[model samples]
Target: MYHRDRSPCSALAVSRSVERPRAAVLLLHGGHEYGTSAPGAWNLPAARMVPFERAVRRATKEHDVLIGRVRYRCRGWNGGRADAAHDAERALHELARVAGDVPTVLVGHSMGARAALRAAGGAHVRGVVGLAPWCPPEDSVRHLDGRHVVLLHGDRDRVTDPKASADFLARARAAGADASFVEMRGSGHAMLRRSAAWHELTTSAVTGLLGLTPLSSPFTGEGRLLSGA
Candidate 1:
């Protein structure tokens, strides 16, 4: 058996499996990203998701974790009614049920970051990694209690405001969540310029959030710890 039921949300790509995963990580890609699907449609392993998917592969090899990469149903998440968020939510639910209640982490980029944070409050979600994340004013403090969140943004990012991520981290901590912010200097929203550094930061943060490793850098970088617990 492929061991999966095909649904719209079930299209997420599953990684190399461990018999009983210690945790599960879902990779959510950004909005306005092109995929093989039609406009206003969702597809897996989108162009923007490649880097994060590589990160997931690296992290899983080092740790006992399962991977889920979600494709959203739309190109935009405007006005707070987003099919992307719903798709992520459904993927998480489906992953949780199949994986047997393991710790769930959502690692997202850009608009996907917004969706991850929105879905973090849902059942089985353990933490969130927001890379160049788009943080809405309303979603900053929702259902964050007892969840861990990390925001990593590039200072040179013009697509998503790094300041907004910093501000949201502060608000999330104040509203009873363990949250932190990291600013990657000399980096861009695409994260391709410092691709190595971006991937390292995301993997290190996710492993640390899982309590499987300390928050130690694998490579030297110009990243600065803005604030955290």
Candidate 2:
């Protein structure tokens, strides 16, 4: 069953199949670079993530995995305040409270992906899947050591630079992370063009990072870029 819980920093819509989940996945959605207003139920960014939530639920139906969709209290990163990252941190704390120290994966898109990557240093986080991430040069990779990080960016994305993500991947690797980058051809920042491929790659990365299953052949190598045509 699904339930919604509101925290000081964000809200979480959680669905769990078992009483005690063995693992968890948290979904974070995109937003602008600067906005402080709270996102309502129908907010396009939050709504856009619903399908990915369903995809994760279906992919992990047989397993004792908890799926959570996080809604940030604010609409943007809001400069160095990083409102969404703080919200994501709080959500991770809540997940820890409900599921113990179980391994967790964070899946985020665009600005949300930036938040996920920032919050990935949390104790429960085992991996991160960033779809069309908005990675800036100053983003840190120091916290990513020993963690699995997968960045999927479309070459056609004009909003978030795919090249920036590649640079971040390189930094993550240098910092001892198991990081890789996937370039989606003919796709854009919203991820609507090759949506199926995005979903497939995300599910594959999540399950694989959690050790529930082996990563698909296409995503096996380090720093490899797969065609998402």
C-alpha lDDT score of every prediction, in listed order:
0.75, 0.85
Candidate 2 lDDT by residue in tens digits, 1-229:
4344655544566755458789999999999999998876688887777778878888898899988877688899999999989989988988887778999999999999999999999998999999899999998999999888998998899999999998998999899888888889999888898789888888888898888999876657776655543
lDDT of 1 by residue, 25-117 (tens): 888888753333433443432666776777767776877788877756566675646667887887887787767788888999998898899
The runs of at least 3 residues in candidate 1 whose Cα sits more than 4 Å from the true structure, single-residue gaps closed, are 1-11, 33-45, 217-229
TM-score of each: 0.84, 0.94
Candidate 2 stretches greater than 4 Å from native: 1-3, 6-10, 225-229
- The per-residue C-alpha lDDT of model 2 at residue 26 equals 93
